[model samples]
Target: MKPTSSLVWLRRDLRVFDHVALHQALQDSAVVHCVFVYDTTILDALPRRDRRVDFIHASIAEVAAELAELGGHLIVRHGDPATEIPALAAELGVGAVYCNHDYEPQALERDATVARTLRDAGRRFLSFKDQVIFEKSEVLSQTGGVFSVFTPYKNAWLKKLDADPSVLAPYHIEPHAARLAPPPSPAPALPTLAELGFEPSNLAELNIPTGMSGAARLFEDFLPRIAQYKDARDFPALKGPSYLSLHFRFGTLSVRHLVRTVRDVMARGAGGEGAPVWLAELIWREFYAMILFHNPHVVGGAFKPAYDAIQWETGPEADELFAAWCEGRTGYPLVDAAMAQLNQTGYMHNRLRMVTACFLIKDLGIDWRRGEAYFALHLNDFDLASNNGGWQWASSSGCDAQPYFRIFNPITQSQKFDASGKFIRRYLPQLKDLSDKEIHAPWLVPRMLPLDYPGPIVMHDEARKLTLERYEMVKKPGPSADQ
Candidate 1:
């Protein structure tokens, strides 16, 4: 039997169009009320002025306004979701609460608590898959077993999609939006930044677009250049990436729509060689999410258990090296510039992410977790699953990760990707006058030249030799004892 009334809880999936939870709620209930809670349990850990908070603040306002235009009301609350969601549903006299699924371990725990609370009150808590097209055991090997490697998994993922195109079909919203209920006589006003105990960040100053409209604008701008993505993405000075990660992180954009659009463009023979390559990148995102779902231990320890046996730098000297790397004073031009970019802005190029991660783990002999934590705190597009997977990949501790012996040489990486020194010079103005050749290695410049930048903190050759010895435990091929 359909419920008389229902409430839809918004989490990462913030938008209204093609929203599964919202669609299901409206279809099943005579009247529906939408809500979003500013979860303090997660927010209290963040700094006072964070770009992600600012982004959400702006984006949710747009969602509320859109709902109002559609003759629906959106209730905003600020508190722990475990308490706030059930409380709001109770106050509204909703018989059922509908929401999309969350995969992170912490999120799973919170959802469980909410579900139990709703059940105790004789109300049902319903959840559906909306974040990813395939999750859990949906995509597996021919033997119905989980695949550890990416290539084989990706092939199976593609084959499954080809067999069932309906998975990409979006959930309808307009047909059922009329079931939305109006606000009560006294509606709760949206909370201010001060009321929420957070300050405004520099997101506005950076000119970063927010909300569903912002995502649309970014996607439109990138379509013309999608063909060049494969060749141009590695160069930091070039505008190659779509720059829609922030929207993707917050669910302002739909993965289904993105895939459908890219495929349509290819069907018309418009996209170049970059089309297939970009599709593979999208698959990589799902692959990481799948890895996290099965291996919760990757959050604290290594994905490959044997990697935990390796010793990392400790004590004061290691601390000093880490500080230098964080402050962009490592003296390696590419590494310094990458760090400077991340510090100044919340975004970093994909190539730079790998370069910096490799340098921190291999060159400085620091643990990858420290670097992963730093990125998690700073990045606007930070997702725990992807961040942890990336760190493990750099440290040679994850499934299908780079070999321990394959340490990246920062100097050659800089020369190959940013040969003109344009990217490095943009972030490190002190090295602007240095020649293209000299910019990559400022220490190599003539002694007569006055340079303010510090010399290389650790020589690449010496660091490489030390790294090989440090990772000696995992050199021989063997199964993970702990796993």
Candidate 2:
């Protein structure tokens, strides 16, 4: 007898708790099966020992173990999910496949193929919004056009949440356990790392545990600092920003639950300005996702078409400059420190991200895409939308992005943000001996005697003047004498 079952095709959403798609699947079917595909299309392009891949694998294993405790097992596979999902569904005689929505262009195409396959097999394909609080048209300008800017979009998002109390309600899944299928007769074997052409990575050393257990640790730790986030988030040496970005990226943590808790604190006036500002950053995440949904071209080019025509430095000189930036030898203390942080930890402070990005395009005169690609490759929490949005924002090619002429003065930024040099000392240990004032720009110290420590590679004033000359070719006449 064919079992009337449903399959939850897990993608980014790795956890069963507070998952909308899983709840709906369990409610709509008598028996539910959860599965995750290690999509080869994405994996094949990654390095052999990618931490993100390892993190996902570990998270999925935990999901499988957790589901087994609830009398169901996670069926894991490696290949194109479009073909694999339908095959699993048909083989199990399931009637529907439920999944969380993905906004990336590649994901959209993959989901379409999977949907068609499920339909051909006389099965249903349903996707739920589980990762983000507001997506696509849920928040729009009064003019009926999508908001290209961040502030207005953030304002509209806040208003919508204010209007609808139920929008932040959690999707309870615990009660639907009975609907999950009893463990299969012969449990499917999980593929080993070698089987998937990947090797073990330093995920454990980074202390970024995977799955629900890790998210719990991160959340508990972050709650205490949530109030001080606005004050400390810019300082890379301080533990301010929630380390939960990777968990959020993979949906191990529930977006609705986060918003509800934060919103409640905001209502009670507990989290202070930190709550709203941090919440705005989260909204910015959704805004970038919506931007990609509407204007996919921003992945490769500028969001504003006119900005695309701007010339960028190229050839061997550009290559050398790019190499210097990548190697953390840019001579700018903050920029070098930020690059080191990224290379060592697969993370960069949000402020440093802006600083390094501006330095790359505005100061180094290189194309923004080069830096974007490097971030994409290095950041553990790298989401395509956020990475592209950040690069565009720095280059002034994106809506609501920083203006091109308003370039970041790296030395001034270091002095202001990392005045104590705590962040710089942590990453670039050679500068640890210098005093707070001298640490920001080591070469300027009156009594410099450190033979090993290299001095500033490029003078700030010279670089700034050269950058202005480079940008003048594309920069329009403006009110300020600086432009």
Best by lDDT: 1
The TM-score measured for candidate 1 stands at: 0.97
Clash count of each predicted structure = 0, 0
Predicted structure with the largest TM-score when compared to the true one: 1
RMSD of 2: 2.2
In angstroms, give how far residue 158 of model 1 lies from its true place. Answer: 0.9
Model 2 Cα lDDT, one tens digit per residue, 1-483: 223689999998989798888888888888998889999888899999898988898889889888888888888888888789989998888989999999999899999998998888788899999898888788889988899988999999889888997877888877889888777678867888899998888788877778889998888887778899899898777788988888888888888888888888888888977888889889999999999999999989999888877778899988988998998987778999999988987888899999999888878778999999999998999999989999999988997887767778888889888888888988888878888887777777789546765665567667667766765666675432222
Residue 345 alpha-carbon offset, candidate 2, angstroms: 1.2
Q: Which 10-residue span in candidate 2 carries the lowest summed lDDT?
A: 474-483
RMSD of 1: 2.9
Cα-based TM-score, every candidate: 0.97, 0.95
Candidate 1 residue pairs in backbone clash: none
Off by over 4 Å in 1: 448-451, 477-483
